[model samples]
Target: MVKYFHNGLDHYFREGDLNKVLSLCLHRFEEHGDLGTEFFIYIENAILKNKEYVLQNLKNMPSDFALRGVVEYGLGCIAASEFRLESTIEHLRNAFSLSMKVLDVFENEHGFCKSVVPFIAKEAYNLKPYDNLKDEEILLPKIKFSKIEKETDFFVLASCNGIYFDRYFEEFYETIRQHNENNIYHIHIANPTSQTEKLIAELDDPNFKFSFENTNRGASYFACMRLFIARRLMENYNCGCLVSDIDVRWIKSPSKIWAGLNKADFGWYPKPGPAPSLLVHAQIIAFSKTQKAFEILEKSNQFLAYKLSEFPSWCLDQSSLFRAVCLTPEAKTQDFRETLGDIETVQRLPDTSLTEKQAFRAFENIEISMNSDGYPILSRVD
Candidate 1:
């Protein structure tokens, strides 16, 4: 979610009636964001509407078998709606526990009705994390939440037409070394031009995985490759692959970014520029190849896949990347969003008191350099 707010969610929050949105979501799955979100919003809104869903759920539950766990979880909402009273204590306890685990999946979402789990956790069970809540909790219960479910390990595929951004390459490689694990892999897909061949060769030290793909289709072509990469990674590595823009420079240690991203199914950051709202950028993106990232990725990708090569070829490569991530695939994404955790970029610049307004200014006047274990330009700097 954007700090300032102005994008899709912002518009709805501002213009749409909250009560109406909730009412529709309760009765229909297609009324809200996506299927997952529809379920979440439905429950949360239902509680706001009547508190009966939560009460009904308390009366009935499921047997141990295999069905749409999401659907079963949806049924659990019936119990969730009655979170406050001390009577359904066992039911409320389970409601909070279950939603707590999946809270990140749906809570505090923007742009779309994507925040299914979080929404249910919030209104029905009065859930939501401490930081996220408007009213802080007193006499807070100790939350021994286990963890968010893991999706597929996301493999970042970065490519360029002739000259690759050596700075980004170094940083990306470094990000992998610093943050990657068995669940996370960094893959670079590029076709550098001859002009930078000498400089490209100068980028030594190898821990990177490279692949060849044609670079003639302009920037949007990368989007197409990302879908292919996601398909390939899911099929071969049992994960999803994201199309990354090498231009994203790390402002902090990539490990921290990866850690936060691990909590979500898919990962995407907003662009630095201005728009009607805080627009998300695809420079650093991960496909929901794993179960987790898929929701996030699909939410972002759905809008992007159709709008191709709309910006500066390389500069706008990611513009559409996040949009494509919003779309849902045929198969259910496996939960790996945090499995290996996110292998993302992080910046290591010293924290400062003053904030810069410009987007790219953070790295301006700074020389792009590297350390051991190739880093992405968006990774830590020494």
Candidate 2:
């Protein structure tokens, strides 16, 4: 399920109605001298209707203001949409430089502006104007696993590209080390560098082993690889696996909860909502070493490949995994409180006042209530 953070303007922009959003943007600009949101809306609308006007307006913006950098970044997006290669690079480069100045000023400021700078920097580095790269160029590095030499109770699997490695993986590793020291961990790394190897060595746990994949396929491909890895471990070694995103941290060991569900082939936490929504939360999933679980994973892998080829932009491994669960006969929804006990998925919000620990406690409170009532609750705090 998708959740949107309300900036006290969601009612005005109901259902993302562009006209209503634009009207409110204009009103906000006039009342508060805040043109950041308004400029973005105008640039989005002008992408197809009037590119020249968008460019002119971006160029005329005061270069001293931080908002100008955001405007330029929007122009870069528009240029890429229009396949204007040289223009895309130029605008993006300018945006990068201007945004750096803004970052210096707002480095300590809370909320949306501060949260967006790193994203802009990442996009500036990764965005390529070329459209004719080969399949091999787009394909992630090939993955190979070390032979399973010992019988392990369960495998915890995760993957990350270069961008998320430092930002999330290090903390994830530390949390697991502190909370789940007994469980074996097999971390699959994509596009591993010397730095990554050094970090793994420093972690220096006997139970923790890592394998590297050569390609840096995007997140969707990494998600696919996760399923593939889980299935392989089950098939070859008769071991169960728990797959989780790197952002997830274990506040307590969940091994007992998972082990108790011996009859289940596959288990997942449904996206919090009313019954019949049945949308599986793909971030954390468990699979027993069973044929049914292997079959579901195989089908999920196939579906992901199909989506990648047919609708690359629209495709997501989470969506594909949900579909796989729906099709599988033995897949069951496990309560988050029961399986994860005291786990939390940490998300950095635009609001700095709302620290991650605070966010986690808030979620724990909701989960505690839901667990008592046997109802799924959906909430987002930003």
- The alpha-carbon deviation from the true structure for residue 230 of candidate 2, after best TM-score superposition, in angstroms, is 1.5
Number of backbone collisions per candidate? 65, 4
Output the number of the TM-score-best candidate: 2
lDDT values for all models: 0.37, 0.53
Best candidate (score: lDDT): 2
TM-scores of all predicted structures: 0.37, 0.51
- Pull out the clashing pairs in model 2: 111-350, 140-215, 141-214, 141-215
lDDT of 2: 0.53
RMSD to true structure for each model, in Å: 20.4, 15.7
**Candidate 2 lDDT tens digits, 1-382:** 0012124234433344444545654555456443453444444445434445344545555566556667777667655544354565567656656655554444443332423443344334333222332322223334455566678667787766655565666777776676655666777777777777668778867777676776634555665667756776556545888777776555545475456445577776554321111234565677878777777776666655554543232124554555455567555545454644433442221222345335223322111112122211222223
